[model samples]
Target chain A: MYRYDEHDQRMLDERVRQYRGQTERFLRGELSEAEFRALRLRNGLYVQRLAPMLRIAIPYGMLASRQLRQLAHIARHFDKGYAHFTTRQNVQFNWPRLEEVPDILAELASVQMHSIQTSGNCIRNTTADQFSGVAPDEVEDARPYCELIRQWSTFHPEFNYLPRKFKIAVCGSVADRAVVRVHDIGLVIVRDAGGATGFEVIVGGGLGRTPMIGTTIREFLPAPELLGYLEAILRVYNQFGRRDHLFKSRIKILVKALGADEFRARVEREWETTRRTVPPLTAAQIERARSYFTAPPYEDIDAAACAGALAAARATSRAFDRWLQRNVGAHRVPGYAIVTLSLKRTGIAPGDVTDRQLELVADLADAYSFGEVRVTHEQNLVLADVPQPRLFELWEAVRAAGLATPNIGMLTDIICCPGGDLCSLANAKSIPVAEAIQRRFDDLDYLHDLGDIDLNISGCMNACGHHHVAQIGILGVDKKGEEFYQISLGGNQGTDAALGTILGPSFAQEDMPEVIGRILDLYVAERHGDESFLETYRRIGIEPFRKAVYGASH
Target chain B: MALLIRHGDIVADDWVRLDAEFDTAAPLPPGKLLVPLCLWNARRAELVARDQPVGIWLASSEHPEAIVDALEDIALVAIDFPVFSDGRGYSYARVLRDTWGFAGELRAIGDVQRDQIFLMKRCGFDSFQIRADRDPTDALAGLEEFSLVYQSATVDPLPPLLQREVRRGA
Candidate 1:
């Protein structure tokens, strides 16, 4: 809900013009393919297998209704009437022509949106929890800090061409919903012992071929000094990060090579000077940013009326009861609840919303909640302010529109990436494998009985699907030019983040669904009263699951 | 011949670059020469005896802080971009210009092209050695690629929100 100011608007408009000029120059042969590739990638345009895929930045995953409409308009007019939400809380359109990308950017800018750093070796779109402001357990609203970072990193001169892409995640809550442990930099807002809120800055976390949990570099960085500390860290990485090999170039590699203690020392040395020269964020400036994210007006509701209506609805409709249990989350506001419009409907790709669905969601936001929508890293859409009284009606309408599957945080909810079907970097196709698993688990009752499970699949080790942090992680691999999958178990993404351990050899694509089924069956047989898959896996270890999937001893 | 672009115009250069084993080549007499970090660090006392203004050439892998003490004596500092994507030189230039207070000319050499002129200039590179194949004048337009910059640079060092202040005190 941060509206663009005059300066912000002008920058985006100028960026569109700049990109148009760059596109023209490239087309006219003033720029070679290799030279233009870096430039185009910086603008979030990737030359995929089919066509150019443009990843648009949904900064901190917040989108206004007007921006959503513009996205729908672009998809209808320029793309194939759909957009795929990414695991990084961004959106990707699959079929934009290379030449019309500037036009697409211009369209996005009209609604104060642009895909500036969605890709490339720069500080990418800073992501935060989707329920940033509305979550009851949150210590502070993270949107303002996210907005500040977005402004600072936009076209940053010093860090425009980093050694590798950098990702930063902000969390203001006790629960790690934003997957902070797997980002290059994770800032958890925390109050100091003296009660002044600052950030616990975690550095060097990443997921790819090598997944690393971030190391806490600073226990408590004063709130105003956040940007200064970040500059110092980037300065160190920009100078020391490996450039010899692409895979070894992430900040995580540098942190590992030099050791976290040495890396922190270097950053602190640089910060000693940077903190003095650069002005820390001022109270007035932070207040100005906070002003943009204040709560919307709400009418006081009668708790008795809401409870009576909810109980009545639950008694009458089992479907309503199921939907309420899975899709609704507690809101900070007394009479309100946060709703997730499931984009993981069966028979379709996870995290994908059609143009009509996008428009319909915008309409629903205007009707039930505020005219604001948030895209989650799980690839779901969030209606963050639906009133408790209106929950049942909204659920019915959304479910009828095919926007609801009642699978938020359920087993059927999957996080997947566009694999070998479209991605040039993928070693195997992931969509078919995801579809196979979703079809096998189509029984709603069975899925619910399975309890909270995080299922994620990545076409390759790029980890865009975030398979490394899932309870059941599937990574696509190539063997003798044949597509196969290697599964991992017991990974987690919450406060205690851990990478999954691989089970035995890779499985054939045809055998993947059965392999998953065997793993689930093993879990059910071994589980004790309400033990989640993660808990059971932790207790029983991977031996049982591995034996079940790959068969017993020789 | 390397065409040196200084102060936004193509200028004649007089600095001679000394390669490795120069000390063993002969009893070398130093003049307006740009020496590598190892040569300077190893033979500073003898090299500093030269009465002429000296310069240093920093490779992408070298840290600028290694010669912070000698930065005052150095008349020019040149940073190389091994590849356009290798951005170590930008941070090197920023460290020299913004943090270390190296006031002499900071030049970008090797693999730098017309399209990178804007970024090079923003990062405090006042002199450029454009790649041999491209026309330097055409690449000069890169310096004017955009009229506005969102974040401050060495050339434009005012924080966006604090521009009204008379001076930003350290």
Candidate 2:
């Protein structure tokens, strides 16, 4: 994890004091409600439908044991004893008193964490792959560049007040776990023929009411010019993006309105000046950031004993075998595996974890894995360096703590947001639909047979849950004051990201479980010889699914 | 009295903001007159015929490139915010100062507030017209708001990283 030095600490301390003063002014009635609203939002404080919600930035989903413990302490004291992890790899506390927020921020600052720029119309917390450094197929470790951007973007006067909120994601692996294609700016680490690595910068991609996949602005931007090119893109966006309406304010609209080629020309013109005028990202600085993410010490594994124990355990315990299949991924280092702690157990909100469970995960990280954990964009936790020898023991501990469920990327493991139940922006509640679907597919064997699938639900067109890019996307819409869900199919989040197509008129909230079931049933029957849902959908297109959902009326 | 913040202090504003109907057929405001971009374009020869202290005010929608060739003719270039969150003025100010090298006073006008004055100054604004509802004197605190910035702005083209490289070379 990137520890805060003196400079980082001083900036955070200043922000805490700044927020404290702003709160005092608001309470003293010196500031208007509307003025206070924008300021509070900049600090990640949202006045929800029922209570105040505060989002805490996990900084590319990396956390240490001490920081997790601090989060647990804050949740128990200030919030409703639990915190919900968001799809952006941040955590949200739903019930905090408006007056106590300054105190909460001060507490967070003590542990090198604050909510600055988490919710504001600024360069937000840049996210990267959860399995960043240890992924077997990764081209470069993206955390160094992410950390560099994090330092450069924080309190940047030129970009802090963009026309609208901006999101930047970086991907270092061939497989895009960070959903690079759906961000305001996405960078894919690539090595050219000469073996020198640079970034392929993609711009104007976002998932709002207008979902767009970004165009490659600079096909190969050298790593040294990262900040310069970013400033150019943001500078272009800040000036030209639509400001008359909030819904059409994202950079995607501007990119589309001007056409991608013209937008690229404008960015090139701006980059020529900014690249020289602004400070450069030196090789020394890049190497300094890389020092923070070096691999932890490991013990040599006894392959004979490990194989014998694994074979014995598999024969004796079907449950263990199922968990091994679903919850583990290959690690670059031999004899170790990346373990995913499932936050998507049925009857619970997709990513809500209790304070005790947080502390338990922290303790488990200290015990079995390294003393750090990574949060995934899919709202799960990762123990990146867990030794294979300690798998059974770690599973036993997490399962006893109610943090283990053998669903990682299965049908029942749904991605959802706290919708109308909590958020004021949501047209309908999303958790119930997610819960109903989870209950409908309770049989683990049936789910495993269904193969890999991504089901995402959003409360509204804001697309906070990323429904626009799921294999089966469900968007909640309000029709004549009634809550209804519109289904979309064939959306994907990999390198070939595409927006899902709508099926027809929406169904009532109660009919969502059956609707999802029908879509899955059609997929299961039509798939040829163990094809994934996405593969089958891509092979046959949306005709069959559309006909199944809307019926044979046509 | 209408006021403008200049060099971190509030002072009486003497410039007259002419409506689009700035009677080109009649005498212009006796003192410095600030007119919209279209009006300036329509009456540029006459406005500069006297060449008495004159300024131009641009809406956020208007381009700063209009003044690229006439930097010396205008004494002040004011950019409009329209609303606090609409940040187009910052970019316009940068283009005026950094690109065009417009050494005249760069003022931020319309809907400007205390919270934004710091960044407005960073973008090369030398003057501000705080909205009538807010106190202009309170905005003086915004000038010295932050001791450091992560990226270079119009105020200082060399951010800390560049400054570090300079020091190493020295």
Candidate 3:
């Protein structure tokens, strides 16, 4: 984890003071509601349908144990006793009083965290692969570059107010866990023929009302010129991106309107001039950032002994075996594993963690991992360096904490948003639908047999839950004041990104469980020899699923 | 009185911002007149021939590139923000200062308020035309809101990393 220096701490402290002053002005009726709205939003405070929601940034989803404990403290004192982990790898407290937000921010600043750029029409928290350093398929660790961008983008003078909120994601693995293709800017760390690390830059990818897979703007941008090129792209968007209609203000609309080639030409032209004027990203600065993310000390445990113990533990308990198969992932270092603490257990809102759970995860991170944890974009916490031999003990602890659920990529593990139940922007409630579906697929054996599925639900077109990129996407739409869900199939988030196609007319909220079951039943019957839902959908197309769900009459 | 924030203090605004319907066919305003970009384009020769200072103000939609070739004659360039949330002026300010190398006054006009002035200053705006209703004196504090910045801007071209390194060495 990147430790805050005196400069970083000072900036956070100043920001807290500034926000406190702003809140006071608003409360004193010196600032208009509209004016206060923009200021508060940039600080990541939103007036939700019920109460104010403060989204605290978990920079690139990396958190130290102390910071997690601080978050738990904030939740216990200022907010409702729980927090919702957002699909962007950030956390949100739904019930904070607007007057006490500055206090919350001050508390967060003490632990080197704040809610800067977590919301609003500005450059937002830059996300990256949660498994960046530990992934076996990584070409290079992306946290250093992500940290560099995080600093550059934070309180960025020229780009603090863009046409719309901007999201940048970086990925260094062969598998795109960060969903790089669906971001405003996606930087894939790659080594060229000469073995020098640079980035393959993708621009204009986003999931909203207008879902777009980002276009390749620059095939290879040298690592040193990352900030310069980013500035050039942002400057062009800031100047020319649409501001007429709120929905059409994203950089994707501008890229689509101008066409990719012309947009690239404009960015190249701007970069040609601004590259020299903007301060360069030096190698020494990158090296300094890399120093923060270097591997933790590892014990030289015999791989054979670790495997033998793990195998013995798995042989005894079927539940442990299932948990290991679903929730555990390969770590680059031998005798270590990446463990995802499932927050998608049924009867709870997906990604909602109580204060006690937060503390437990923090304690677990300190005990098993290197006193740090990572948040995945799918709203799960990861202990990235868990030793293999400690798997049974960790699983036992997590199970006791009610965090161990053997449904990592199953239908029950739905990615959801805090929708109309909390958010004012949502057209319908999303949590209830996610809960209903989770209950429908509670059988673990049936889910495992069904194979890997990415079930994502969003309340509206904002796609906060990333419903557009899921293998099974359920979108809640309001039709004449009634809540209805529209189903879509075949969306994916990997390198070959594709938007899901709508099946048919929307279903009533009560029919959601059955609708999803019918869709899955079609997949189970039509699947060929352990083919996943996505693979089968890609092979047979949406016609079979659509016909199966809506019936043969249509 | 309309206030202008220049060099971190409130001062009398000397420049006259011409209305959209200002009579361009009539005589030009006396003293320093800030003409709209359209009028500047239509009466470039006449505006340049005048002895007094002539500046141009552009709408958020307009680009600074329109006056790239006329930087020598222009003493001040103002970018409009129609709305504070409409942020085209921030980038335009940078283009006018850093790219075009405009040495004279760079002013942010229209919808400029206290909260946004610090960033406006960083983007190379030396003067601000604060929205008519707000107090300019209070907005001055915004400039000193942060003594340090993470990224380099027109105010300080040295990157924060390099600046911090130098400070550490010192």
Candidate 4:
């Protein structure tokens, strides 16, 4: 985790005080509602249906135990006893008094975190792969570059007010866990023939009303010129991106309008002029940032201990053995296993971590693993450096905390956004719909048998829930202020990213879970044993699912 | 007709006679120049060296880095506020004075609303070229936009960074 130095601490502290004054002025009726809205959003405070929602920045999803504890404390005091971890790897508090947000921000500053640029039409928090440093497939850890971007994008003068919000995701490994394909700018760090790591830049991919896979604008940009190239791209987008219609105000629209070839030419022209003029990134600076992410110390432990644990799991718990096989992954160092704490329990909200659960996770991280944790964009927590022998013990502890569900890749594991029940922008309440589906299919055996299905829900066309890329997508649409849910099938979020097709006309709120159950039942009946939900759905188009969902009588 | 020399456009004042024929190929007509905000760039240095008309207009996208070098050669630099809410050009004009060594006439053009003049002038923009359709007198009041700026900027060089660092002593 990147610890804040004096300068970082000073900046956060000053920003908190400034926001506090702004909040005070707004409360005193000194600032108009419209004027205060932009400022409040910049500070990550949203006026939701029930109360103000404050999103705290978990920069690149990396958190120290101390920071985790601070978040737990804040969740306990200021908000409802829970917080929702978002797809962008941020944590949102559903209930916080508008006046008290500043105090919460002040506390966050004390722990080197603030919510600047978390929710504004500005350069947002740059995301990266959760398995950044430890992934064996990695060419180089992308965190250093992500941090560099974080520093540069924060309070940037020229790019503060863009046509629309910008998202940049960087992936260092061959496999794109960060969903690099569907970002405003995706940088894949790759090593060229000479073994020098650089970036393969992809531009204009986004998912709003229009979903697109980003096109590669720069095949291989040298690492030293990353910032300069990025500047060129932003400069082009800032100057020419559409502003006439709010719906069309994204870099993708500009790129589409210009045609990828023309857009690429313009970006190249800008880069040619500005590349050498920008401030040079030195080796020392790169090394200094990299030092912050250096691997933690590991002791040589007996492999026999891990074997003994596995033997015990085999002897006693078949479910635990299955979970260990599915949820655990390889670590960079020997004697350690990377453990994923699944947030997707059967009937609970996905990515919603209660205050008590947060404290427990923090405690688990400190005890059974290295004092570090990561939040995946898929809405799960990761104990990155758990020792192999402690895996079962950690699983036991997590199970006791109600965090272990053994459904990491199953149908019950859903990704949902706060819909009309909370968010002003949402057309319908997605949380209850997700909850309904989960509760309907609470049987672990049934869920496991259904196999690797991604169920994503969004309350509106905004697609904040990433409904477009789920195997089973549920989008909430409003028909004359009454909530109706639309279902989409066969979407995916991997190397092969595809938008799902709508099943049929929208269903009523109560009918959603039943419809989803029918679709799942169809998949189970039609699927070849080894076929995943997406594979099975692709083999037989949306017609079968639609027919099953709507019924032949209709 | 007042012929404007944009930042990157060549000044052709000497070679081609505007009265007789306008040569699009050659640089912008030299002499006293009026430039649009859209054309300011590195090419300004060449125009400045030629001692053509000495006015530079800043585009809305133009940052402080664009005109930091040409401030000495040009007699006047005008900043365009493409949109009324766009405060970027204001910051650039301020940086021209404090950060870079720009000392000549500073003008505001484009969407120069009535409410922005005060802050524009406070930020060191002296001259106001209100849009052709807008009322200049009303727009001139825009110079008095903000009465107080809590944080210092390029116009007001000292931020809290240089201020006393709150020392606690006995």
- In terms of docking quality, how is candidate 2 classified? acceptable
Model 1 residue A35 CA deviation (Å) reads 0.2
Q: Which candidate's DockQ is highest? A: 3
Q: Over the stretch B19-81, how does candidate 2's per-residue lDDT look in tens digits? A: 655666666767888888887888788888875788899888888887787678889888888
RMSD of 2: 2.6
Lowest summed lDDT across 10 adjacent residues in model 1 chain A is found at A276-285
Which ranges in model 4 have alpha carbons more than 4 Å from their true place? A28-30, A551-554, B1-74, B82-170
In order, the interface RMSDs are: 5.5, 4.3, 3.2, 8.9
> What does candidate 2's lDDT look like per residue over A1-554, in tens digits?
78776666877888898888889989999888988888898889999999999998888889999989999999899987899999997999999999999999999999998898889788889999999999998999999899888877887777767878999999999999999999999999998888888999988899979898998877888888888889889889998888778888898888889998999999989888788766677766776777788788888887568768877887888888888889988888878889999999999999899999999999999997778999988999999999888888888888897777898988777889899999999999999999999998899998889978999999998999899999999999999899999998889998889889887789898898888888999998999998999999999998888788878883
Q: A1-554 in candidate 4: lDDT tens per residue?
A: 67766666776776787688768877988556865787788678888887889988888889888888898899999887888899898999989998898889989998898999898777888998998888877788999899878876776545665778899999998788888888999999998999998999999888778888888888899997887688778767876787667899889899999999999998887676446444445676676667788888787977667777678876798778767866788877777888889998766778988888988898888997678899988899999888887777788888898888887767777788888878899999988888888888887777767768888999999998898889888899989989999988888886677888988899999998888878878888998978998988899898878778777765
RMSD of each: 3.0, 2.6, 1.6, 8.2
lDDT of each residue in A6-105, candidate 1, tens digit only: 6678878877887888889899998899989988999899999989999999999999888889999999999999999999989999999999999889
With candidate 1 superimposed using the best TM-score fit, by how many Å does residue A450's alpha carbon deviate from the native? 1.3
Candidate 1 Cα outliers beyond 4 Å, as residue runs = B1-4, B18-31, B38-51, B161-170
For each candidate, report its DockQ versus the true two-chain complex: 0.37, 0.39, 0.55, 0.07
> Please, what's the RMSD in Å of model 3?
1.6
TM-score of chain A of each: 0.99, 0.98, 0.99, 0.96
Q: Highest TM-score: give the candidate number.
A: 3
**How does candidate 4 fare on TM-score?**
0.82
For each of the candidates, what fraction of the native contacts does it recover?
A: 0.40, 0.39, 0.58, 0.00
